[model samples]
Target: MFPFYFGYFDPTYIMLIPAILFSLYAQSRISSTFSRYLQVRSYKGITGAEAARIILDRNGLYDVPIEVIRGHLTDHYDPSRKVLRLSEDVYYGNSIASIGVAAHEAGHALQHQSGYAPLSIRNSLVPVVNIGSNLSWVFIILGFFMGFSAFINLGIWLFSGAVIFQLITLPVEYNASSRAIKQLEENYIIDDDEVRGARKVLDAAALTYVAATLMAVSQLLRLLIITRDSRD
Candidate 1:
């Protein structure tokens, strides 16, 4: 199916080149923006952990524990555990990027507190998305080897969970960024200039999610096209 998917068009590699290049460009831009923000010191000089704490407190979510995990950009919110895990850099650094990222995670805590619809939906999808992401490729490969249409269809359905998760995640991420920026401004955690830097960092990070969603959708479309052509 993989080969069949690409074999239908003349110079199929050419069609993929643009998508690959665009994905790369998006990733590069996101990285560059994050790097730039990481260099900019927050005007208030608050550490990332402190910023997260403040945001959570402001949202009446003082119960959410913030912890430093050893990794780079591995920061995330665990809804099930009611914890915000920050990377080593984000937990300790006072850079705009660190604070912005921390604040965004805290926004998730706030979302949980407020019962935000998108965040709720995203949390609901986590289990299925995890299973789907891990098993979809395996099923796809097995289906191809066995020439089993049922297995292939099942793989497609499983993979679709990942695509749905990506789509649902876009709003969750964007809203988190929006909440982060607003909280920063409202609490005076960052000055005007620093807020601008934080905005850049959050915006750049959001693009990464957008890129992932687009890539997933592209692959799903390719699979559908291949499945259709196979029938003919």
Candidate 2:
């Protein structure tokens, strides 16, 4: 069963090598760009927390709180509790990258407050996507090995949720960056020249997500190929 499903463990299935290399390249580029932006201090020298506060205030969302979390680039917005959590570096750093990231999270808060449809759909899919991502691969592998076509199809359906989730995430991220850039310009958080750096940082980061989704799609395609070859 295993041999039939996995093509006798051929070394040539190593196309994954290129995919891995691309993923690493994307991650490194994003990190490097963000680090460079982090070194360029904003003209206002406003810390990330302060930047977030000002953005929220501008949008009339004064009650949403900002907290410093302990991680590198592990910042996110919590819609359930209405909080913007930033990494320690971003929370206190007075850098273009820091302010951009802070405002991005604040943008999520604004989206939540403004009833953004994409964000709302993303929030709704979180639980289903989480469960599907965990179970899909296991079912696909097991079903392929055991020659259970039903299980293979079920796995495909489940994995589709993850793909959809990744696709949906793109707009949420892009819109947040848009909001951040506009806020930065309007509030004078960064000058027109400096805004280009912020855009680069955010754009590089967005590419990582794009890379991830492509990887997932690639894997699913590989699985389909394997399943087709096995049937013969």
Candidate 3:
């Protein structure tokens, strides 16, 4: 009975079903959308790296260097190092998807330069969230095994910090995507017809973050339910 209470068979597992489904759909959607746009070349015929450079320079982020890395959808901006890293496809390819992704990373660089509030807050929470994320499962498992309610509560609190981090990240990512689209359009990097393709790519990418946040919230709710059951 005790094993059943803490195992996958636990009724509380049902809470995660919807989140898991949504996450799968989000992942699939992003992949298909990105792949589709990746085949559609931008009319401007500018490589992704060039697009990023142009956008960065337009915003006076000339000091931020762009580097190319190998992988799919691995592009990101490193605020700590003040560098922009783009995946192979995004850095070298001239597709609408490539340009959109490159500009998105540049937008993150812009966010760092301007000290965007959400990005700043998310950055500040990194260390704490890292610690909490790593230790949370340990405490939760130990508490359940030892029948210690205090430990369970501590684990829940730590996990809550991670949830807050995810919540803050939503705005940061959304703002970056918005900045990317606006810059791409205003500068004529992507024309009106191409804007739809770029938007689809960015919006699909944003859904991934939404899926992540939903998954986290669902897990937190499940933990709370388990704690309540333990008390009962």
Candidate that would win on lDDT: 3
Q: Rate the local accuracy (lDDT) of all candidates.
A: 0.85, 0.86, 0.91
**Per-residue lDDT of candidate 3, residues 74-129 (tens digit):** 99998899999999999999999999999999999989989899999999999999
Where is model 2 more than 4 Å wrong at Cα? 1-18
Q: How close is candidate 1 to the true structure, as a TM-score?
A: 0.92
Candidate 2: the clashing residue pairs are none
Tell me the tens digit of each residue's lDDT in model 1 across 1-232: 2544333543333445556677788788878887888888876789999999999987788788999999778999999999999998899999999999999999888888889998898889888889888888888777766777787788899999999999999999999899999999999888888888898888888878888887788778877766665567
lDDT of 2 by residue, 185-232 (tens): 998877899889888988888888888887777666666777677677
Residue 9 of model 3 has an lDDT of 72
Runs of candidate 3 exceeding 4 Å displacement = 1-8
Give the runs in model 1 whose Cα sits over 4 Å from its true position.
1-16
TM-score of each: 0.92, 0.92, 0.96
Q: Who wins the TM-score comparison? A: 3
The TM-score that candidate 2 achieves is 0.92
